[model samples]
Target: MINRKILARVAGVGAAATVAMGLFSTGAANADTFVPLPGGEIVKTLSDGTVVTVRLVGESANINPSLGSTPVHRNAWVSGSAQVELSGTGADSGGRIFPGYTVGCQVNIAGGGTSGGVDGGVAWEDGSPSIGASGGGDLSLGPGQAQSFYILDLEQADDFGSETHKKRNVFSGSNGSVTWADSTIGLSGCGGYAQARAFVSVEVETESVVTWITLYGQPFSIG
Candidate 1:
């Protein structure tokens, strides 16, 4: 004796509302998607049958927008550490067969109505036990557009030498961290999506033998 038509209409409305809520929740979760980057590793053998392995691990980034700026600027603080290990006969040779190694990091920015890039790295001399860092970048603004690039910070250890050599040559073990911060700004008529990337490199050297390897992380977005 009930109104069958009215009951069916109410049920359909309830089902539609449930589906709408589910779609909204999915969109919200996707907005917060931040994927963790994968690390890369490489291994090389010296002339004397010495095996050297380099790895880039614990890589991450933090992106932020500048405050109170007419043309908004985006900055990223990228952090990670490089590890070097020697095995086989030359593993324990220290400065005898293995001189030392160099570790470095660089950030590349492209798109978002801007163009430019920056990079930096450090060298460790086992014989001198010395450490040095070098960095540089380039940037130019487009018509009716304003952009800027900067290498904000770099941090590394300075313990690659001993009393005698003051800067010991390369050794077999871990060499702390090589971190850097870079930024890019876009203003006025500049309004588009920009992309950024982080990369690491390692170099191994001896008196007569030398080799180099590099790895890059997945690219991220900055708007």
Candidate 2:
């Protein structure tokens, strides 16, 4: 017969059984404990087969220079063609955002992109056929501030492009207070085409917020 005392020690319950027996005794076998490995980040795969990677690209204050007065604000954004490939058995909807994945984006402007009179009244707004030109007020950078935000719609097509190629206007996860600058900033026209061909738009989306800070003085306001 197997030694009961040796089994208890190997089983890791020898001490418990020893107290009951008044002498060293083997303990019953206990289930092995399982420990999970660390370091695997969970990523959501969307229905459109798009993978949403969450990360901080930049901050609003770092991107926008116009917010030097009240708060240092900036916008985080992502732009480029998207890549889609079929791995398993799944249907293609032409234009559909895969569920589980999220595309969050934000964008701010330089001093030149601000409102009228404040920054010489010159406004740098981008416009596209689908989403159109977005104004500074959308970001609520305040009177002298200006910024924009964006994200992939994944579902609807706002810009003019091949449905088979996945053409859609980017949307903002933020409220009406935040929005994209315009298609004109990067895209050529309302037409989402590159080199006059069906270009594949594979790009990543970004998101950000405004960080409040103090602004400096001007030549007139100081002296």
Candidate 3:
């Protein structure tokens, strides 16, 4: 009778251990809930009556947790592709008009606070290690500000044509992957949450007219 009671207790402990392991597995699966960002598309009509459509597709990010910490640091890799299509009566006829424009995409990371004891972190290019920049200045966010970094830029100047009629050129490109790393004083403060976003810009030019349009993508967390 003593031996049988001991065996029963051991079996009960084993069953409880199995249930605990199963719960831990379920929690871990739920923690990795970051999904792909939704792509964006927009159409705009320029002053010259030209209609341009811009699409941002295949957007994704890989976020890694802090790598231990004195100054806590986190990393992320972002990638996506963009395309521009031109169609309108005002498009230059028989000439390469689209190639004269400039197309680009930028990523923005923002978080933290200043006076409220919140710590706004700084982000830099992953491999190149350059601090982000915008409007010809260093990019850093404090409280409500955001810093923008270029993902890709393409110029269509070499594709110009001599045709006197309406010219249309379609521009499309991909930003394979750009890595970004963020550093904070420590992760224990009020400004712990960080987000990443993407945007596309286009500059359209004619001999006498110029127009600009920009589209923004949804924001995703990096933590």
- The lDDT per prediction is 0.31, 0.18, 0.34
The alpha-carbon lDDT assigned to residue 65 of candidate 2 equals: 21
Write down the lDDT that model 1 would get. Answer: 0.31
Q: Which candidate is the best by TM-score?
A: 3
Per-residue lDDT tens digits of candidate 2, residues 1-223? 0011100001000000000001111121112211111111112244434333211111111122222232223221211222222121121212111111011112111121012111312232221111222431122222322222223232333467544322232222211111122111122111111100001111222222111111101100000
Comparing candidate 1 with candidate 3, which one achieves the higher TM-score? 3
For 13-104, candidate 1 gives per-residue lDDT tens digits of: 00000000000000111122332445555565667566665555565444443322533343333444444555654454332111111211
Q: Model 2, poorest ten-residue lDDT window?
A: 12-21
State the lDDT at 27 in candidate 1.
Answer: 11
Error of 3 at 124 (Å): 20
**What's the lDDT for candidate 2?**
0.18
Score candidate 1 by TM-score against the native: 0.44
Per-residue lDDT value at 145 in model 1: 28
* Top of the candidates by lDDT: 3
Per-candidate TM equals 0.44, 0.21, 0.48
